[model samples]
Target chain A: MPMLRIEGLDHRWTGARQDTIRVGALALGAGENLFLHGPSGCGKSTLISAIAGVIDVAEGAVCVAGRDIGSLGSGARDRFRADHIGLVFQMFNLVPWLTGIENVILPCTFSRRRRRRAGNPEAVARRLLGDLGLDPDELGRKTAGDLSVGQQQRVAVARALIGTPDLILADEPTSALDADAKTAFLDVLMRDCKAANTALLFVSHDRGLEGHFDRSVDFRDLDRGGTR
Target chain B: MIGFSLRSLWNRRFVAGLTVFAIALSAALIVGVEKLRDGARDSFVNSASGIDLVVAPRGNPVQILMAAVFGIGGTGTAMSWESFEWLENMPGVAWAVPIQMGDNHRGYPVIGTDVTYFEHVRHSGGQPLQLASGTLFIEGQADGAVLGAEVAARFGHAPGTVIVNAHGSGDVSFHMHDDAPFTVTGVLAPSGTAIDRMVIVSLAGFDAIHAPHGTPDADPLDAAGLAVPPRNTRADHETHEEHREHTGHDHDEGSRAAAGTGEHAHPRGRDPDGHAHAPERLNAVYVGLADRTGVLGLQRAVNDRAAEPLSAVLPAVALTELWGITGTAERALQIMAWTVALASIIGMVVMLSATLESRRREFAILRSVGASPAHVVRLILTEAAVLTGAGLFLGIGIFILAARVAGPVLASRFGVQLDTRGFDARELAVLASLFGAGLAAALVPAIKVYRATLADGLSVRI
Candidate 1:
């Protein structure tokens, strides 16, 4: 079975007249990377929100590790996501009050399975951060809010890849940086995902960087629901 | 979880600190109210305790307590000496002692009673008045007086020192008993009772001075700021002149104590030689019964059977009713304190609820990372509990600290001892209720976080 699979999936915002995101079938195998591309307000983030179980799913099947997430309750879905998936939010979803290393190790505070798989989660976080060309010793002490935008994005990538989950979801993780910093952030993110051999779903409004992924799927191509 | 909660609080510790303070004040108000109420009752319950009934001319019983026991007001219609004897011979009466009053030495009431007062009178739960200096006055000792601790301290009359008296309650008195003098033979310890503000004398000496041709006047209250007494007779005369000059009261050829004669007498010659002469008039009589059961019957018996009109007041009943009459004010204060606690609770809830809007993205991130909805709620509730618990502890600390600081003043003013001790069961219950209130208030915010939709995963809306 593939690491991630979606079949006839549909989602709608509360009180909306029609499904806002619809996908007939989408699949990614181990080590496969799919660049999910669309412009702003194209429902790219909504699709990833469902795939990550950040929102409850009811219409159709959304599966990770061959278990349909729609079958699990909200709480179980959260556990499954934390165990099997790494999420890298675009705006650097690090707790601002914590240090860089503390944010990197936060997932271990929640999922014991991930902590066990990481084999010393702190060492794993440090290794991932160092592999991404960060000065772990220095950046580890700086609060997440104090880091530069590019540095913060790399730390987010390190946080996502710490546990070597089977899947990684990076949602425009470089959008906040300049052109030079964006390429640099992509380089670190791709390298970390390839090193972990995890399937990648990279959501973005930018389509110019499609060559780096194994495949690219546009939002309009996947979601047949009407959207401007 | 604790680390997360603490770090989160450290993020906005100023707001958290203010909230903690509000809660602490509320808790202190509640617990302090309970303490003061108990303290007041304890003080009243022990005030002038030992005697079962007070027999005085019929009037307000509470007023009798104020005047006689608390040394607060003027002595109401004096109980006659005949009535004192009549009360003594009653069927249920174990003992009765007549107390005469009308004079003051430096604002402390001068109490004239026999030596049996020392043997039978009890204070603060049957605790006898232990002497801190010298000896109690012997029955036959002429003009020898026992000073209560405060009176001695205020008037500077140690053993062997003679103190003169004024003719009325010290506040309005214009006369001094320069013709009648009291020799301080003993000083009682600070009993934290009304006796601390009185000078005790033998009944015989009291009558000897107040007998006919004993109308001399001097102001003892003038002695508050007077210089120390001179050792020689000449300096005594000088201080006496100073007293007369300041008070505008006459100091006649004062009571002469002829050293070799073994007899002291008013130089006014009211009594050529001071001798034991019981008076025909008395102010009040305190009675102790043989048993508790006959108290009401004895009260009725004394009221109905006395030849002269007299009333037997159950001291405990009068005092409790007095407290009840004033109890509404206590209840109002208590209610005001609880309102403060309620405000603290609501303030805490409002503060926590405000944080929910700012914490939505954080909550979303937490949920995305595998925290259960229960975990989300727990985080918020745990934070509330920590703050409220700390506030309660701070309240208790302030309560004890304030009491310790105000203990002496409270002792002097109200005779209410500051209860400095460990948390009693009621205090513990108050603490528990505070925590419960915190949880209840936190639940409003907790459920808000739990039911929250994670729409802005990486975006900070607030």
Candidate 2:
């Protein structure tokens, strides 16, 4: 079974501007790495939200591990997301007041499945931080707000990679990093996803980073027949 | 989650601390105002305890209570001493203490009563009066006086200090009784009642001062024939000069005449020529019933007396009635205090709402980490509970500190003793409602954050 599958999904933004997002078909197998490239405001974030169960589309089926999440209630959808998916935003991903390890282990605080799978969540969080190229000992007591931009991004990556979620969603996460730091961050992120057999749906406007993934698709190609 | 909430608040400790302080101040104000209101009524009620009835000239019952027990205003008429004697010997009457007023030592009222007044009177929950220093004045000791704690402290009077009486109750009186100065022989302990502000002397001394000069043979009990002595006389000048020499200062006199002739000058209401006299009239009388059930009957009999038009009132009932008249004002004050409390809670809501704009990104970050909208609501409610709980505790501390500092001042200045026995049920109820109101008010911001979390998801606008 694929980690995520979407079929004939359609979403209409409510309010003054009535734009629609339509996805005819999409699938990512377990452990696959797919890069989603698009221009800004091309509905890439909307698709990410749909895959993560943060939003239910107005039409169609969003299935994770063969279960259609769009059919679930709002609360159930939230639990499903907590248990099976990890998200990384562009910047300021960590709660600034929480320490680095605390932020990394936060997913387990809400999801019992994640907590049980992590097996000693604190140790797993420290190892994940160490694996992501940040010293766990140094960051253990330091708040995320005190870290450098590169360091904060690494902590965020550690947070996403914890508990070995079925899929990792990266939403232009490296947009704030320098070129060298961006490449370095992508290398570790891809390595961790591959090792965990977690599918990766990396969305960004930048096209240079598509070389690191197994496959790449433009967001415009996915929404071909949408009524703009 | 609560830990998380606390850390978030600590991150903004400066603003959170100010919010808590504002809540604490309102809490203190609310509890303090309640204490004052209750304290005032309790003091009034306790001042008349143990005495069943206050018998005075016919007039308003509350006025009679104020005049007789609280020493407030005059009774407007004086009851004959014979009436007091008659009440003293009435059936079921345990004891009756005659009270005479119309003179003051400086601004403090001088109460003219016998030693029975000290023995029968009880206050502050049936506690008997105790002298802080010297003994109670002798029954017929014309020159002897016992000062209340406040009066003694105000005038610095102690054993053997002689004080002259003034004819009226005003703070300043020019009609000084220089020819009939009374020496302080004792000082009473602080009672937190009107008694604390009185200078008590025997009726013999009170009568001698008002008696007409050289009319030794006049009927002593005749209220209509008693005359005021001329203000200026050779004896007055001689006594004033001796008083000046003895006292050193015109305003206050110390104990220079510790063994002066004032002690033995006219033993028990007599002139040097050897005449006998007694008090002619009385302002009021405090009566105790032998049996509690007979109080109403005795009160009726006193009021229905055929010889004189007099009124008798139950002290407690009269005091409560007086308090009822002022209850509206007290309730207004209480409502104002609670309004201040409500304003503080609203202030907390406004503060939380103001920070919601800045914390939108934070909420979005939590949502991305799998915190549900329900979690967001709980987080906000927990923050409100924590702030109000902390504020409640700090407010209690502030109230206790204020009560400790203000208790004695209120007792001495206004004769109101604060019940500083810690948080009572009513106060706890106030605090509980305050906390409940705080959380309820916080729901406003909580729901706002919940909706924003659902709408913004992982993509916060800012």
Candidate 3:
């Protein structure tokens, strides 16, 4: 089964503009990397919200690891997300008060399934931080707020990859980094995704990093019916 | 969840600390005010514990109690000596001690009574009066005086110190009875009552100084049908000799050694049953009944006396009436205390709500990490609980410390003994309610965050 599958999805904002979003179909297989590119404010975040089950879709189904999350209640949907998926935002990703390892092990705190899968959450968190080229000993001593931008982004990646969720969602995860740092961040993120055999859905407005992914798609084309 | 909440609060420690301090102060005030209120009531009630009734000339019962027992206000009229003799010999009367006021030494009330005053009167849990030094004066030792613990401590008066009497209870008295100085025969132990501030003297000594000068020494008890010879002729002549010896010196330092003074060498010596110099009038009398059930009957009988207008008050009933009169003020103080606690809780609500605006992004990050909105609500409530719980603990510490430090001063200066046993059921209930109030108030901001859209926090606005 695919790690994530979305088919015939439609959503509309209840405003005077009544803007709408539509997607025909999308699927990400296990251990695969898919790069989705779109301009800012092109309903990309709205689609991400729908895929994450933050908002119920007006039509169609969103399935993660063979379970239709759209059919689940709000509370159940949240549990499903915690157990099967991980999300990394572009900026301000870390809960600034938590230490680096605390942020990485945060998913396990909410999901017993994730905690059971990870076996030893702290060890797995430290390994993930080390794999992302951050010194676990040094980073664990300081709060997430004390880390530099590049270091914080790496920690965010480590957090997403900690429990080896079925799919990793990256929402412009490397946008804050410079060119060299962005390239380095992508290399480490893709390598870690492949090692965990976790599917990666990388969303970004930048297209220069497109060649690093296994598959590439434009969000504008996917949401063909979306209006400004 | 608690870990997360604590770290978030610590991040904003400056504002959180202030909120905690405000809560602590209010909690302390609530508990402190309660302690004092209870203390004052207990002290007032306990002051009249052993004595069943207070008999005084017709007046307000509370005023009569205040004057007779507490030495607070002046007794309006002096009942005639005939009425006191009648009350003393009345059926079912266990013991009666006459109290004559209107004199003081160095701001302490001078209570004129015989040895029965020491034998019958009790204070603070039915404990009888005890002497710390020397002995109780004999019945006819008219020049002997007993100093209360506080009076002795204040004036540095030991057993042999001679102190001249003054006319009134005011701090400053111009009518010094230098010719009628009395020797301090005993010093009473601390009683934590008005008695601690009294200078006790025999009724004869009180009459000697107040009697009109140059009149033949008269015995008022003879008019009350007790045939006793006039005995003050010899007492007056001895007082005159002592006045001459100490005329040029300070009266307070008259004779430090009772034996050395040689002035007490007299022929009338100690007359054990002598009522020879009893006064013509008495201010009030404290009475104890042998049978508790006879109190109401006796109280009515005394109040109905046709010969002289008198009021006999059940001390406990009068105390309850006094407390009732002050209940409104106590309730006002209590309401003010709770209001302060409410204001502190409101301040906490404002602080939590204010921080919610800035913490939107933080909540969004938690949401993105699969934390349910309910989880966010729990986090906020947890923060409130921590603040309230910590405040309660610190407040109890503050209350106990303040009580320990201020207990002695309040007892000595105001006669209010604080109950310092920590965290009684009432205090615990108060603290628990405060915790509940904090959580209830915190929901204002928690629910706001609960209703917020994930996109509101996830958006790049912050």
lDDT of 2 by residue, B1-462 (tens): 899999999999999998998899898888888889888877787788789989999999999898788877778877875587789889999988889887888878888888889989999889999999988877677778999898899778999898999877777888788878898999999888899988898877876565433332333423212232212234433433443342212333334232122222323443221222234467899999889899888888988999999999998788778988888998898899889888999989999999998898898888887888999889999999999999988987898899899877777667788877776788788889988988999999999999888898878876
Q: Model 3: which residue pairs collide?
A: none
**B1-462, model 1: which lDDT tens digit per residue?**
977988888887999999999999998888888888777767666657798998877778887766667666745566655577677877878888778776778667787887778877888899988899999988656488999877777657799998887777756666767667888999999876778778898875665455433333343322321232222235434433343232212233344211101112222122212223234457788898988789999889878854777778898888877897779988898889888999999999999999888788777777667677778788998899888988998988888888889866676556566676866798788779888988888999888887673445434445
Clashes of each: 3, 0, 0
Candidate RMSDs in order? 7.8, 7.0, 6.0
Off by over 4 Å in 1: B101-110, B140-184, B192-199, B204-277, B451-462
The recovered share of true contacts, given per candidate in order, is 0.63, 0.70, 0.61
What DockQ class does candidate 3 belong to? Answer: medium
lDDT of 3 by residue, A94-205 (tens): 8888899999999899989889989999999998888888899988899998999999999999888887899998999888899999998999999989998999999999
TM accuracy, model 2: 0.87
Q: After superposition, how far is residue A180 of candidate 2 from its true place, in Å?
A: 1.3
- Two-chain DockQ for model 3: 0.67
Better of 2 and 3 by DockQ: 2
